[model samples]
Target chain A: MFRAGEVDALIHLGVMHDPRARPAEIYSWNITGTTKLLEYCQAYRVPKVVLLSSANVYGPRPDNPQFLTEDAPLLAAQRFPQMRDLVEIDHLVSTFLWRAQGVETVILRPVHIVGPVHNAPSNYLRIPRPPVLLGFDPMVQLIHYQDTADAIVAALAPGRRGIYNIVGPGEVPLSAVLRELGREPVQIPHPVARPILSLAFRLGISSFPVAELDFIRYVCMVDGRRAGAELGFRPRFGLRETIHAVDEPA
Target chain B: MHTAGVGLLDRLHKLRGQVPDDDIAGRTQALVVRGNEFAMRVARWLYRNYFRASAFGIEHVPATGRVLFVANHAGQLPFDALVICAACFLEPPTPRLVRSMVEYFVPTVPFASYLFARWGQITGTPENCRRLLAAEEAVLVFPEGARGISKSFARRYQLGEFGTGFMRLALEMRAPIVPIAVIGAEEQAPAVNIKPLARLLGAPSFPVVPYPPFVPLVPLPVKYRLYFGEPMTMTGDPDDDDDVLDEKARIVKSRIQSMIHVGLREREHVFW
Candidate 1:
């Protein structure tokens, strides 16, 4: 499909993130697939490219500031091996962005995309009784899937190119979000919950990976000012509506 | 269990009614709004009856600008931070919600993780401090950090080596630093730190008081006298040399140290 000047833009959203999937399969699909896509875009001279990357590349760290800028280092893969493919893909695209000067590559790192999706945050919220780390309720940021779509659309505009952290309306405590959704959270001690969650994942009883426990335990929020200033992007969903989006019929 | 959440709401609403118009200006959430209401109630009681805390020079804290309240931290627990927050909230002409920076380990702790954020506490990151200051909000920072909080009883009232991070933040944000000296917090729990025990537990500092229950979980009800000094406006490059930053930090440290001495002299009794 690489006819010169045939494709104006390429939107790369083909990252596979199945925590239960074999690591080799995920690596090939994510890394090799992104490499091939970027090669095609570069060869085809695709004028614009928008890559959908989650803000989770920064990882949920105990020392992270409440709002991380776009320039913050991607350190999620350090602790969670499952995140390696995603982080590697991000690095690959970022390298392409710098080298392929002809291509306007835009990376949209949206915080926890919820709303009518089968993603982890949405799926976790859908649970009637989600297991919460006992006493750990970090402030969480979520972006509606539709709002994420809006951000991608914004990035497609002419002259929009750098990494952007697309945020939703606002941030709220995880417990408050659960309360708003009316979900009863089972409090499990951190030390024991890890083993139980790991066992559950192995038995195919739960889809959540053990490493993802950090999401509920620490703050991994980002600053969306760059998106607002550059892309003129603002979330259309309110905090209440965004949290309630998981319950919306898919 | 469901009714318990309702009971908590009822109490929170009653507490909300008692506090002045809430002033969490920027980046607020539902929990923070409600949490401030509850914290205000607890802070009032602790300031008045529990600690009998007296706050002076609270007027130095600007009502409508970004300000950093640099205070001397003490007590095995962080009752010192609580008392300083209480002083800023209750004594100021207009109630200000001080977003104090907390320790990294705080987020790992169960209830403290979210509860601290809800009550306007943030992790001690320069970025978090910069953002809060940029939004014209009040932030409380303990330059002494862990060193000051975990000081043993023998070294109580003697200031620890101040960290230079807050000075850089104040300089970068151009926010005035209001030095605070909190007397009586050092006497709240006179304890010695067992380093080996702390290392074995993988905790910061293992403090053991000479009283019943050993661990200084509940601080003694000693009088908390908060001396808020004039706001010091620092002018320099935030990225200056460490020695340069240290010299400037020493100025604020000495200011707080002098205030602590004055507070100690004015006090007649530790409990009163």
Candidate 2:
């Protein structure tokens, strides 16, 4: 499709489906591939380009009590699989288009995009039961699928050039998400967890990649106030709504 | 007049059969092979650990052979040379073949000498230099020589006066000189102060003192970084006068100094 010019814009999704994947591998696909595609688009003179990146690019940095802004430095260096890759891809796209190609690039970095369509087995729903009840205590910012789609559509409008962090209605602790799913939570010590994860990694059964373990230990949260103010991106569903919807039948 | 003529005639007769003996040729061959093996092992290890070593403007090294690696010398340790060798070996196309000009003192040690000799590392002698270049081998030379290694810690990376011999050799051999600027070596041995006894013993250009106190003992894992600048092609005619050679040498030295400065500026903190 890219070679034939059948595509006007390319939405690079499908990076995190494999949780056991390496950070470099994810970076190559999502970030490097996106940059190459953008270069191709620029070469072919495609005017509008849209990239679906992760708000994890902000990294698991300490939140300022105040809401995070898009102007904040995308966490360029992190131990997370997708975070560093996303930041690099974001930079590569933004710099290439703005500096070299002059193509209008709109980047949407959404945090923990969630909704009913998230059927992937490894989605937060499938995490081992123990952590659910204990409430992992990790602060999370998420967006509903409808809001995600809306943010993607909004980028299509005129003058959406740089990056915007698309976050959900509000932040919630990790334990809350797991508790909502009705699973027991266990606090595995890091030393024990690391070796077990490494062994599982060696055996090739554990869904968690080593890089993901880094993020589990270190939290990442982004402020989407810029996305709200500029793109009018308002999450249609909050944590309560997600819980209710998940509980309800199709 | 009769005595002088007799002496001259005797010298001429002795010069007739001046070919290198079989033992010497065999020794040279053995040295080259050993050197090759040592270089290969070091290169492979560095490749696994810190290979590619972050290079910028490698286009400066000419694609062709007979290029000279002129770099700064820091401390008595040969880390800079080892790094350069490793970096060149790991370069894209792999400059696996480099003949570093080592000090004659290096070969005095049994194991190190054997390795250096095997790698075709020649003493920075004019004869050996010409022979190596004539054989089309890449020669690495530190023009600052002993002066560079003996400098105070505060003056590290600030190149001392480059010895003119490397320039003269390059001009004579008609080789392109590649200026290399290396960082992370000075910190490898933060010379607190040189002991007077070591200097008196002539311990590797002594008194100035060079040894990383924490390493090898406590094994402080100091991060090492190296940079290679663009090759500054010798512009003047090879047959140029001594003045021309001096001028070319100064230019090469200045280029190397600038590259080192750039590397130092770009780095956040030197030690660590």
Candidate 3:
């Protein structure tokens, strides 16, 4: 519905992450659909475009530094092949950001967005007894879904182009977040958790892929100083509020 | 939709419990305070009765501001780190934390993963060190890294080849480097490293002490003497040549080496 000189900004937030959806379907919607949308934006002379990317593009790595900057490589797809779609979409938008002469592309990679949302982190927290890998409690960063929305709105400001890691209240250990939510996590050994999760996924009992277990095992936090400096964005939520947002009713 | 979210936040803010208004670092420090208190009690017990550790030149550690405590690393385990941490907590003008750079593999371990971070220990990364230093916090580094820790018993008190990372960070952040000489840790677990075995086991080093329980799990109770040298400040390009960085690093290394010699001469026995 884009008419030339009419649409001021095109905020692209459409990306598929349905665990049940086929990879082919996900690729079509996330890649092909985004390509068409970017093409349309370019043809229609949209001045600004904000893409909602994720800090998971860096991947939950055991060797990751406490805080990853924006310049860090997007290597999420190295281990988990399923993450290729999101990584590809990020690469596509970033390429478009540099190539598109007129369109101002802003890529915001926020950390795990919690709150009254049906995302992986929030949904995992919602579980009364989430499965935690035994002996591995990595520090995790979370942004309230509202805070994430605020970051997008901040990016919509004119001249705020380039990538930014939108952090929230702050980081805490996985156990601390679980304690705040009053979750009694079932500790599973890392070696056996994979086969069990894989079988459970095959049996249609669990939606979490075996590859996704690394989220609870390794750290993938990011530094948000750039966002704070450039976009003038900061989360209004406290750490306790951010962690408790998962339990808030939708 | 935006209004609803804001309203919900405002409502939650009103009904807030005793949630501490602090960022991650502050929250982690709060946890560290609690954890440090308990750890200090135990560490003090070990320092006084068990190891009989004596900390000298404690006044060199500044009561405030960011400082880099560069020390010698030894003991099959990190009792040296513990003793250094305990020394800072116990003997400083005001009890302060000496945040040590833990190994990357620590995150994979169970209790140690989060406990180390809670107690203000961080993974050994330039970014982590730079951030902590900028925040005006003290950080501890062992430039010898694994090589110094897993050295054979024959090489006790001999300084390993120091890496130049900490020197660059020290110069970049403008934080003074406090050279620490931890004597006794080198002799705590006098084990020989079997490189082939370490490779087969996919471990850092395979150390086997001469005594029973050859793994060096429980260190022999040796007296720990920590000498804190005067804080040294170097000014130069942090991204300078490796040779330039190494030259500065050698200065710190030699300082620690000389302190270690003095400490060795002063001690009458290992288990005093």
- Evaluated with DockQ, which candidate comes out highest? 1
Candidate 1 accuracy as TM-score: 0.92
Off-target runs (Cα >4 Å) in candidate 2 are A1-7, A14-32, A62-67, A81-83, A100-102, A116-122, A128-136, A214-218, A243-250, B1-272
lDDT of 2 at B123: 51
Encode model 3's per-residue lDDT on B103-190: one tens digit a residue.
Answer: 8767767677767776678889898998889988889999998888999899899899999999999999999999999999988998
Candidates 1 onward: DockQ, in order: 0.54, 0.00, 0.39
Q: Local error of candidate 2 at A162, Å?
A: 1.6
- Which 10-residue window in model 1 chain A sums to the lowest lDDT? A1-10
Per-prediction tally of clashes? 1, 14, 1
Residue A133 of model 1 has an lDDT of: 91
Q: What are the chain B TM-scores of all models?
A: 0.89, 0.75, 0.88
Candidate 1 on B38-63: residue-level lDDT in tens?
A: 77778768878999988888788787
TM-score of each: 0.92, 0.43, 0.90
Query: How do the residues A1-250 of candidate 1 rate in per-residue lDDT, one tens digit apiece?
Result: 6764688889989889887678998899899889988898988778999999989999999889888998899999998898888889889999999999999999999999999889999999999999999888887898888999999999999898999999998877787788878999999999999999999999999999999999989889999999999999999988878888999998
The fraction of reference interface contacts (C-alpha pairs within 8 A across chains A and B) present in each candidate is 0.73, 0.00, 0.60
- Pick the TM-score winner: 1
Badly placed stretches (over 4 Å) of model 1 are: A3-5, B1-31
| Whole-model lDDT, model 1 | 0.87
